[model samples]
Target: MLSISSTRQRQPFTVLILICLLLLLPTSLPFLLPPPTTRPSLPTLRSPPRRSPPLPPSSSSSSSSTSLSSSPLDPLLSLSTLASVILIHELGHYLAARTLNIKVSEFSIGFGPKLFSFTRSIINNKMNGEEENIEYSLRVLPIGGYVKFPENYNSSLVMEEELKGREKFKEKLNVEKNEKGILGMFEWLNEEEEGVVKKKVKSGSKPKITTPPKEIEYYTDPNLLQNRRPRDRFIVLSAGVVFNFLLAFILYFGSVLFGPGLLKTEINRGVLVTSEPIPYSPSSGILHKGDVISSFNGVNLLKLPSDVNVIEKEISEIIKTIKSTETGNEIEIGRGSERITIKPSLAVGRSYPTIGVSLSPNFSGVSKIKTRNVFEAVKLSVQEVCKVTKSTTKGLASFFESILPKFGGGGGGGGGSISGPIGVIKLGSDVIGQKDWSALINFAAAISINLGVVNALPLPSLDGGQLGFVVLEKVRREKIEQRTMDDVNAIALFGILILSVGTVFSDTMRLFGK
Candidate 1:
């Protein structure tokens, strides 16, 4: 049997460094790849015409600014939101453990040096009046948090420390002697004399009393996590993700019902140009930012069938029109009051035909709908959670799917939009800086859902991984060796850290538009 203390010892720094390097190798690939101009061209077409019609420009600028600039307090607010999510996650586990009559030794937010700490004595009526002293602490780092149980500790070491702490507490309570100079000296002398006189006939003789050392007690409560039934352990392990989902649901429900309602946008105009295109691409230098693409190949975008997939349909139609023509496709864009027409053809890239531009749905109008119907709100929240979870799961899967091939000499990588803690904070800050607090609420809910989905992945060291172990134990009808499980967990944790670092690197790259 391996004690949890020994199992949690820091892993080799070299091994972690190696893993991080391996994981981050893909992120450094952009630097090695040839620049856009130097890359081999797959398909090319003649330069197209550009015309600005004598018409009033489109005033399609919405309230939201496209700038991603950050304010001073934006990062702080984002960090606070992240901390709140983590705290809620830990609280889920803590509450579940307590509900199952499990003794929690500590509940801590964050890691590293402690900022504030306190001990709470909780009386468990089911444990024969046993008082559980749980130490709760807030640390400096806001990265993560945890809940600890006595079952995870070395019994002997814990007992020794408890005894030492108790002794120190008693020493603090007793008044110091001889600290007041002459007055204190007089009090000490009087106390010594009184002690000697009370002993009787003990002049110049000290009466020594010795008591045997107290025996240390170990906690053998059956309610300890490892001692509990497999089902109970499963609940405790899965509770974190469950709480994350619940938090997302609550936020969505509150926002949709009580807040400014849900934002409903109709894309009756055209797709908005989100960012600049890569250099030398078809749309490069031609389609400027804030341009509304009103039509493609003489087809009006407003005439397209409207639905949830309308944006995707429009994009698909645009691509189809580009590929269908060798004489270049006509593109009508609305920029302020001017109606501009540009003929640009698509270029074949390493993967697919691309114009090297990003586009999003251009809203014709925006409205908010508030409903007092509880059932409607509940339905909407549930739908939102499920949709987010499904998309997050797919995105996570695709990211790995894309990156795994890079390890096998595959040229391209990084398919889906992935963000780590740092990326999320930056995004949250940007939303706040834009003064769109409603979007921030929705962003928080989305983040919560993402957290839940990621933690529920059974790739080791996560909640889902732990739940898998419990199931395995139940099937085997025996417990796995703690050392073996610890080793697996350590490896998995290192992998997670490497992945996090890689994501941060990716986020940084994206921030710089690399």
Candidate 2:
């Protein structure tokens, strides 16, 4: 029922161009944007380092068992997983609509031409008596999906059809009543007594009840979504995001309870210096590739609370010490069995002060551990989802905050970076190459949460945007003009398409840069 206009149909080419621009723009950002005129002279603390690339196994046997060579199919697997996530999102909308007895026109995965399609008649218990046909379809493009509701639900043509259907239902009821004879007559009389049917009699004469009611009213139509209550509309609009979150939680719980289990990184000793510092850097002569830093300026790094992951806490403390360094700074290191202390003179007033060395937790190894029971799995999964949701919300808020200023010619948007579909596929491929299947599951869960968070944003063309309109209608107590709403949605959709292209392009450039 939702038709694409000729102008809208030609947007794919424009989208392609945008994608190309996005892909190429990041690589050219240095030349396109002017350098900052000022810089911070003081050292600042930052979050812990991102996970390092997976290390090669030490032995050939370990390599064969723990790692896999990169394959051509890696991208395909990643794409499939993404499609599955999108499909589940659409399904959520479909289920929610059906639950509310709202008629849905089509449920589709992907865009463009239909690869496959079928229609099924679903019987709604509240339909006041019949089935509505819904089309399920798969389209050629694997980019995204949608659940379509009839665009002209309130049109005269639709009202006419509904009238005919109601007439037929009334006839069916009359036939059943006639078949029941005397009992049906009593049922009709009871209906008249209860005000279900209007009755009239001459002053003193007894009223005569017909076998069938003279009129059948109060037959509510629950088929049109727009005609539903605001609460129902909100539920339908928000169901996709809810489903995405639920899927992520399920994946996390399964990974912890039934799959390869959740991964736990055991920290051993202190922070391992990943690479030696540059020749002229502050840590040049003071640190080496294998040095394990045990303490910073007399603060013991290994002493941590029982309930915390020491790696993040230790790294935070180390960074704090380095940022707060004054005239003298000392680091205690463990080299084999020898305890060595070194004082490195860090350069001041050079943006962020650093020891100029790559560092990570001195991890003994990674191990898979499962929850003791289903209850534990549920608890852990909920915690993981909550943690991820919190971090994602902060990250999204920070990204927008950073980029918004840049839009007005202000600086510092460089920190608000993002990746699109291509980036996700590439990340999945890397996980597959590492053959850390458990990590892959966790990655999928994180992606699922990310999808939910993005959709939940109050941005145009997203689910949240539609929800906003619904809320506005409720507050105003009047429906927004259908044409106006359509135009807004069309414009928003075009903008999003352009953005997606750019994101894809940017991600491609990043992939190649790596």
Candidate 3:
């Protein structure tokens, strides 16, 4: 063996030791450093789509009485609830007229001209000021409401109280106001032969088709509503609007009180820490499917709040805090129930933190009894729906007036908007991404309002429009000839056609993202 200096031998030994240590450093350091702090995996989290609310009781009318039942298929909406909305709306008009001691000539659902009508007068029954004919009619158009008043209504007066300057259900006796409105009834009495006027042989004969023809006179009491006390006439006229408003409110409340107990929401698990580097997102370095996430970032999943508002607000804050923290946020998560700290290292902009999987809500939250307090729930729900409806209406109008125009809304061959089944499904997906339950509720409510408004608009051919003409005659004091009425009806029909085509076209184009 070649002999070397003692110094050279020691140096070679030192170099060999350094290379061995370098080889084992990675494996050794992991054991030396404490694992990213973590907590228990909360497997109980759930998303809204997982829960399905109970369906309403089916309508109980025999034959075709139950509208929704007519169809055997279950649609996106429960047929029962949707049908109930229509029934209740018409009922509002009927009940309101009954309250005021006013007689209804007929009541019908849907719009357009009348297709079927039946009339009847009460004989010897008195219940809550309802003393006369309970007429029920169905019009040709099946999308609206109609009520024939005994006399013209003027809502400016309600001697006791104005219906908040609105027309609502209430009673009024012509009272001592020989004021043209009441006097006209007296004048009506004058026009009839005394004997014919006193003709009371039969019971329950229709008040409208009474006695001998010679004794009666048309417009006998007409004083043009001008001579009546403002309050008196006002109350009578306000009844229609009041009834409609109430019906809408009831529908609003009913949706919440008895609505299905499912929301379209997402199962979002992300780091929620205040002092980490960069924001923690589902696709960030630290967030992973196996890593347990908590409100404290790496600690615990949040316990959902009893109050929806608080839950939303709290979650929002947690997210903001986590995002604002420094990049490479160290989060504590429980993987396989083993608590460990996960350093969600940053990538680009702190957006993608991942363990590699798309998550959905597992229906695992405590099953809540939907709407324990009916009244409170109803009130909240109605407000939510109304707000949604109003906002959506504004958005729709803006979309047509502004957005559409900008994106092909400028008339000629406008890339019209449309949403077919595919588009509608996409809408639901977008909704889940955008907001929580409240937003979903509002979306539902807004759709209902839109349906109501469209049905109620007094456009040509629409039921409301026909009713508008009926109202205009009384308000405008100008009689429309049958020919003129026919012409208006024709034009309105055309308008409806145009609107339908445009709507469908727009929906189709929109689906194409035009």
Candidate 4:
């Protein structure tokens, strides 16, 4: 039977051998390829409030102050740095006045009653007008400052109005028709003189006495602000904004060249302690305050793999994973010389992972910047001005949109409230303590930008507001009625006074947590 069996029909011995070889291959495969090495367990995420350390004091290098993230709220306020922010804005006005040879009577640093002040000089009587020279002083309010230019009291446009009205009267009967404007303009001037009427002689009892009236001098100077061309006046009026933007740039450049500049590179490349836990969290303990995070979830945050060509793409992926991850899922992280697996706990109210710690980026050579070069400093200064103006517009737009409502007063809840000087000081101190100079520099730039923007708004009391009037005159190709514009300005001024009062009230209300 074995000799006659076909090739397809296997013998029992051959079938048994084939079965033995198949079984042996499974045991020998391990010798060809070894098993993967074991990975170490990571620290769990956890921390308690009592275990948190007290906040460290800030360190200011020179008078130029920049701080690390002292508080989340600090970066949100650009208006609170009154000295560096608001004072510099006023400097713009003063310089602009000087540039156009316009006389500035007073410069007030604050809005309310005087805190302390002194006049730069005694009265000069430029126009010899009834208005005496004002001795401007600093006010208790530290929010803003102003420059008083000559003719600001009357606003040059006002003088032209009186002259035009009188001239129209002179031409009414002889040269033109219906050109006298209002019929009763003469009544306004003559009402005061009516008191000194000459006595008329009665036919029998009184002799005619027409004594010449004593000459009353009205202060007039044609060469001053009244005589300046609208274009020139506009230049002077617009100069303050120009100077404010300029100063903003200079400060910004100084901050960049001398202080910490914006970090253009990835944070992992910089000097930082990634292990500090985020505040008021439960995971603070499982994560130590000193350990540096080398990688997150088995992927190194330092160098994203070659397949991840762009850093932003990797970051997007990481964020997506963080958002999708569930609480019971284990997080694989690399610490200094150790691999740790942590089971992420769900944070009560957030969509993101709550490791309860914030990491600082490493920055080298922060203490080595210098702002001594004249030309380079000036160039950087200019760039900064442009940068700040652009940034201010962008940031404020978000708040106005109610996208994240933070500041107080709004159709939305975002107008959290205005943070005054106390808030800014607290922010400054907090940042300095954290040693985050880059943040501080950016903050200063932001404030300067805000100053420039607010000053440039076309409001009656602001520099831009006055500029708007000048533009109006240019379009009309003639001077507008000063009284009309002045009246409009007066209303505007009142509105501003009310706004100031509101701001004070708002600040007070916020202090008491109302």
- Predictions in order: lDDT: 0.60, 0.60, 0.38, 0.46
lDDT of 1 by residue, 452-485 (tens): 7766778666677778889999999997755457
- Candidate 4 lDDT over 285-399, as tens digits, reads 5556645456767676656432212333444454456556687787666765567675555576864565555443322211223455667767756655655455445434432
Arranged by TM-score, best first = 1, 2, 4, 3
Model 3, 95-152: lDDT tens per residue? Answer: 6445544445556554445677676777524444434665576755343344444433
Q: How close is candidate 3 to the true structure, as a TM-score?
A: 0.37
The segments of candidate 3 whose C-alpha lies over 4 angstroms from its true place after superposition are: 1-72, 75-84, 98-103, 109-118, 123-379, 402-447, 455-493, 504-514
For residues 226-264, what per-residue lDDT tens digits would candidate 2 score against the true structure? 667889989988898899899989987997787666655
Clashes of 1: 5
Instruction: Superpose all Cα atoms of candidate 4 onto the true structure and report the RMSD in Å to 1 decimal.
Output: 28.9
Alpha-carbon lDDT of model 4: 0.46
Please list the residue runs of candidate 2 whose C-alpha ends up more than 4 Å from where it truly belongs after superposition.
1-70, 123-125, 142-144, 153-222, 266-365, 413-417, 490-506
* Residue 246 accuracy (lDDT) in model 2: 97
